[model samples]
Target: MSAPRNTAGHALVHGWKWLDGFASFFGAVVGGFYKIPGTRPIKTLLHGTWPLGHPLHPMITDLTIGGYTATVAVDVLYLITREPGVGHAADVLIVASFLTSLLSIVSGLTDWNSTYSEERRTGMLHGLLMVVASLGFIASIWLRVAGAEQRDLAIAVGIVAWLVLIVSSYFGGEMVFGYGTEVNRQAWATPPTKWERLDLSESSLDDRKPVVVKAKSGYPVFVVKLDGTVYAMGNTCTHAGGPLNEGKWVGGDRCEIECPWHASRFCVKDAKVHGGPATFSEVRFEVRAAEGRIEVRAR
Candidate 1:
């Protein structure tokens, strides 16, 4: 991305550009972490659980931030009211937030790997901000665990860290709302309300190759013939709108197709995503043959 010209928005623009560089460097490092063996279980535990139909990262992040905010509030009350119990609770929460953040970082990174180029740039910046905030909290935790005198310093550091984390969360929000990360593939799609007939005859169904057919409402659907059964799904790839009809069959799987642009794989039978880059499943349609003609309907 080229640097924009100096204007009313120059400072904001340049600040993001600098952050883009930092994110690129930091993402390069996280990419290396993938090389460490025995990471599958961790990926499954963090990403497989879709709390509230959203990725685990943001939910975990909200919980972690909530814990941090509670710890900060507890620290303030402990100082003002001279409650030893409050101080102890704050320490426990600080550690708890740190623990939850580990899973949040992992899940976020897993999703980030599949983000679009523009969103990934912001994703990395959000990650870097969290990293800095983590360091502050980790430092504060060390001091809090050391005892009473260090507790004052811990509170000071923790308050600052909590504020930093809130800002980081804003960037994270931008990645989703502003950039459409992890959103449903067909959220904006306007598929036909009623079933539409496809020109292909039932007897002419071919295996492993995809054909694009327009639905009654004009949404392009990817129709693939596999053995005797026919599969139909939205032609657009869920990840970035790459045309699925133009994509290729995933090797070894006749019922699956891979997006040519990003290689996001979708199962033809039900349009379920077995692999991603694409966190969302492909938009599928009900396909059947009636009176020798093939028809597809939005599901």
Candidate 2:
């Protein structure tokens, strides 16, 4: 079902689409939205280089959520035992959570600047909530350091902040599972296991030109012929499902297909990433020509 057009957050996200303009303006003035930095290494690192195939922001979020939740656990323990040491431990956790939240906030903003359309608007609200949560934690720290009389109130606010953080996290998940921001495009995809016949005549394919044809399993398969040899891989780009068949050959040697959408380059020979914004490799396939037809299957 389509999302509610006039819901509570409608104005905040898409009030006649005017909010998009303001958001675009804000992002451009602050951090050059939609213009991913040309520095490949830096963009790769910030975008999705660490944690093997995952983005760094998600890795850092574990600490942010864990540290904040730890403080709540300590707070409850203090309330139950009336132990001063437990309160002290809660203070430490709060401070740590605040620090890690800074990193999470920064990484999130970096990702946010790269996001577009409604997802970008949703991310803005997510980041704002995180900032509010951070402020609450900082305030809790100040109050705890001030005196014992403020400890109870500080814990109260800290718990409230933790709650807000949870809500913000829900939005984050929505962005990924719902809008597919920074998510692997082929995570649920399954290539055909058995050999599948290509619909086109082998002679129809031109050398070095990629063609997108449906495999037996029906998922799009990218087929390319080079040097009298045919190659096949998943038609969907691993980065964002951009049509690889529509992409142009890159690397000046025709070894890669540069995605037209995000410019994520994949090696035509192996489907491995030859560039940034796509950490995962595309699914490779084996192909053979028989008589007048081309056949392919998952590798």
Candidate 3:
């Protein structure tokens, strides 16, 4: 809930620091759940790291939010017109929204598991609000399903749920625009346009051992030799800017490296993400050896 450094210009956000303690504990639980054997595959899909190359939570959240919004509109119309058709439409929309909410929760948790500190706290708060709102919506649905007598009560409950959803959505936006959660760490990285020489010699690099070198553009590059060929990529992991050099090599035939922080994996050859929690590829640098020294350029 507290930091050693000064926290200014975040007055409203700082007030929510009390939630950080809970976030740390729950975040550890989420991290442990994913670390369990046979769960990584599910985690990968939830993160949308493979096919989408972006976080999936944001992709599906709109469906749930939109559905609920439409349901609220129909509910208001039912209140004014008392039309049976409008009421039926509202019922259908609430059901669809409830289902999609489950999806958004799963994907959001998958991404939140990789967050830390203030981002984790904000995400936890956001998730809590969403869950509460979803439960309220579920109750509203149950009331509507009970009988026609409870229709007005259902509409009231649904409207309250929508308001909670709106507040929760604000926290979700803060996690992105404010904290950059699940955002591509290397998005702004500019690879070296020309060859850049490193201070170390080729012989100095131990086979299969990763090293960090700065490109002409001052961006760090991760360099490693495998099977007598030197490969280079952005040293900053696309997941959360974890130092790739600090991470260990993983995967036998895949030429993958695991991020030290969140365990996200990336292919060394193409810099493509090979695991969850990291949806963007690292910036690959073309590498070569000349006069026993290593050189790299943007691919």
Candidate 4:
């Protein structure tokens, strides 16, 4: 038992050692392909079509491939019975997965080009492994079609592909969690919750320019005035903590303020999102005029 345990532990360590070198080398090779100057423009163009107010490429790729991978085990079981209907169903799933894999590859390349150097390398490794796994699955599907008798071969290939995908998924998780890829970009925000009394007696606010004030909690808050009404929100932009007070205001009625860094816009009235690069809304505070002084409370 001790011998077996030692052997297993050694294998595990050696396995990871090999994986680390392989992933690093392959990541460097693939990352170089997307580092060309022309790739950035194309990737930026694709980013425009991404859904959910963030980069769309990653989301779509995950959905399409994740769905297909999830269904593969069940499909394999159905194929084992040699039922014509089951085979037909599996075929549809395979084709869908293949098409999605193609789409993922294209969008992933675009995203890969824009990533930071370290993240790009890690993302490249994840992408390369996924591509190999996807190709293997595709070939397995071809074999299955050629002869249903090759069902076990197809299942074996699928299992291998699934294992590869698991490894790729781990790397992908590292890209997001470790490297901050496609993350909320605004997860550490504190919402407006306290009422601050504005010293309106001071003449500095009369010009209607944005003013920064400290909340009771010592957090910086931005205040602006329009039509005798004062509005307040967190001074920090939800995306990357940009200063929102200096941002340009567009139009009236919950005037939209655009972040200078990433151009994320938010409404002054309720802090609702007006535009992208930021999915979360700003923190808004309710204000009341009292004896020529403006007092604010969290909404």
The numbered model that scores best in TM-score is 3
Estimate, for each residue in 204-266, the C-alpha lDDT of model 1 and write its tens digit: 757767788776666788887787678888898776678888787764756778888756677
Whose lDDT is higher: candidate 2's or candidate 4's? Answer: 2
Question: After superposition, which runs of candidate 2 have C-alpha atoms over 4 Å from their true positions?
Answer: 1-22, 29-38, 49-51, 79-82, 146-149, 201-207, 251-254, 274-276
- Return model 3's CA RMSD, one decimal: 2.6
RMSD score of candidate 4 (Å) = 8.4
TM-score, one value per model: 0.85, 0.81, 0.92, 0.63
Quote the positional error of residue 39 for candidate 3 in Å: 0.7
Mind giving the per-residue lDDT tens digits that candidate 2 earns over 66-100? 99999999999998998998888888888888888
- Which residue segments of model 4 deviate by more than 4 Å? 1-62, 78-80, 98-124, 131-157, 179-188, 198-203, 206-208, 226-228, 249-254, 291-293
Model 4, global lDDT: 0.64
- Colliding pairs, model 3: none
Rank candidates by lDDT, best first. 3, 2, 1, 4
lDDT of 4 by residue, 49-166 (tens): 2234466666666776675676575667676675778766766777777777776776665545445444555666778788888878887788778887886687678768877877
Q: For candidate 3, lDDT tens digit of each residue in 45-150?
A: 8999968888899989999999999999999999999999999999999999999989899899888877766667777889888988999999999999999999
Scored against the true structure, residue 105 in model 1 reaches a CA lDDT of 85
